[model samples]
Target: MPRLFLLAAVLAATTAIAAPDNPPVPLPKPPQADRTPAAGPPVPAEKPKEKQAPAAPEPEKEKETAAPAEPPPPPPPPVETEDRAAFEACTAELKSLGAAFRTLPRIDDGNGCGIDKPVAMTRLSAEVAIEPEVTARCETLLQLAHMTRDLIEPAARLGLPDMGRLKAVHQASGYVCRKRNGAETGKISEHARGNAVDISALEFEKGPVPMKIAASEAPDLAAAFQRTLNAAACLYFTTVLSPGSDDAHRDHMHLDVMKRTGGYRYCR
Candidate 1:
């Protein structure tokens, strides 16, 4: 029995020693640290944009327009008078005598001497022309026309054969608004009243022939003719002033028909 027990214990010890070695069990891993989500792909670092300059403003355009037209000048003022009938009668008489004339309105010179029925004589008659025009009274113009046709033309023809006919009489002075003898303060002149005329030259078919009142300057024939003309003018005109009269009469013959208290005629 003892031998049998010893054999059994020996068999158990041998069985334990003959078994293979087993692997050790692994320990559980600590909970992993909280994971952070990865940021989306890194955005490329943005470069700073450059600042641009502002554009310049455009210039304003000018408008095209025409300027307004200017107004016209005013007309001349008319003369005032009340003697229309007398003026019309005088104008008609002048026309009837074949004298070319125009009636002028009254000229009030602010002084005493101003004609009421003045006539501007363009021609004495169809054959006779008044050069440089003459403004005179109706009575004076009529007398002048008669004298020119009768005495002046015939006398001129005798002297100058080439003077086919008397074309014009060059007048030095006519109706003038001035004092006597051109004095500033005095009685008004006959010229101012359109009652006087000054003859300076005579126009013929050829040309103009200036009257030389100085006897020394005139030719022998011309001197005699001038003397004759002066004498004839004295017969027609109440006042006749020639070269020998005064320095004022040295260049022209001044003639007028001024009535005197006595029938006294002044001729020089």
Candidate 2:
């Protein structure tokens, strides 16, 4: 008990204790360095954005100028039924029939007179050669060839057996840019468009027979042969103006591919 009393008296006399209301004083601030910049005056409140008039619409920017619309594209060219290629389906027929021919450059004489795909035909088959060669569209020459092989030659063999195998065909005109019947102008002739052929005579190994021969003067068999040949031509051609049809075509057979409805044909 005496020791405990002595320890309590020692703790009460220590100087670490202080009165409850008293506190220590703060220390002074240190001196600033010489190189330190003094604080600047308060920035003048930013002047409230200096209210000014709105900028003039940026000068309307030239309205970005409409960029001139490109001129409308040109129109497409007109299409025609005869515009098929030079040797389309007819090429196979030409080869099969043993024809000698070559494609020609386009013939455009303007004013609706032209052949888009022309051909120069020298012969139809071994049995028949086109004297002077025919310059017309492939379709036109093909028609003539088919007629020669299937009709004319066969007719000659049967009608004029004395004449050796029909050797050649003498053409009057193939492609001529003139009016019908050589008139000044009424309507353009099929020859002008490379769509017609004119056969003036038939040459055989024995001799030649002119187309303009009068029926009365011609031998009975020859007259009959001409009539049959002319009739058969209608089956292959759209127009057939055979000998004696008219004075204009008396010296030749004027055959053409004249388009018509329902496969119409005019065979005189």
Candidate 3:
């Protein structure tokens, strides 16, 4: 105990001598850490709460997207007009062939039926009269003229030799604006476009005779004439429907200038 008292007095004397001007200050204790984490369940170590920098504020009112432009409209359909050069040329040719025709107003029954330039055919020639007249395009009459002048007249002289010269041709249909075979619905007929003619009967110096009777009874002469007419019509027209071709054409001959692809001619 005496030794400890003496050591203490010596430490005080040394401290006093070392710091005579200033007294020694006591140091403060540091705070202890609570290493024991949250109570309840053990939480995953909160990664040292990362010190994050503040972010820029977002816009309040949203911007709208732009709209796309509209597409262009389609073009109009082609107009149905007569070709001045073609019409004039056809008329000139028809006049030379002894045809009596007058240019008529346009015939447009809409619904896919129209004739740009049509003609009223009074007669093909003096002898080959168009009984009751007919309305057709120039091309049709031209084809008829070619068939009658070259084929019909010659065939009549030889086949119908007993009946005398053919006086006139009785037409049944031309430019009537009806469907094929006169159906309620189907492909538009060639006659609707002024491209066809239906011959119902033929006239001789003797008198008029229905084609049906002439075709069967006069099988030797008159029937030969009908056959010749049908066969020869195919040469001039792209389509020719005769008595035996189908039920629709059994009574009258249907001839048309309807152009087919590859210059194909339909003879039936």
Worst 10 residues of 1 by lDDT: 73-82
Rate residue 208 of model 1 by lDDT: 74
Q: Which wins on lDDT, candidate 1 or candidate 3?
A: 3
- Pairs of residues at least 3 apart in sequence or in different chains that clash in candidate 2: none
- In candidate 3, residue 114 scores what lDDT? 70
Worst ten in a row by lDDT for model 3? 71-80
The reply for model 1, stretches above 4 Å from the true place, is 1-93, 214-219
- Which numbered prediction scores highest in lDDT against the true structure? 2
**Model 1, residue pairs in steric clash:** none
Per-residue alpha-carbon lDDT of candidate 3 for residues 1-268, written as tens digits (9 for 90 to 100): 9999999999999978887576668886554585554379777886888888888787676767677666654432222577889989999998888888899888888755778898999889866789778998888988888888899888888987777787888899988877788898657788778889888888888777666623444647767777778777888999888876787877888888887899999997
Mark the regions of model 2 whose C-alpha exceeds 4 Å error after superposition.
1-86, 213-219
Ranking by lDDT: 2, 3, 1
Candidate 2 lDDT, 21-88, residue by residue in tens: 66768886666686577679877666567779887776555556668897865532222335454468
Whole-model lDDT values for every prediction = 0.77, 0.82, 0.81
Off by over 4 Å in 3: 1-80, 213-219
- Every model's Cα RMSD, please? 17.1, 21.4, 13.7
Point out the higher-scoring one by lDDT: 1 or 2. 2
lDDT of 1 by residue, 13-108 (tens): 997998759756789866667856658989998899888787777776667667877665443222224367766776676677688988777776
Better of 1 and 2 by TM-score: 2
Question: Candidate 3, TM-score vs. the true structure?
Answer: 0.67
- Per-candidate TM-score against the hidden true structure: 0.63, 0.67, 0.67
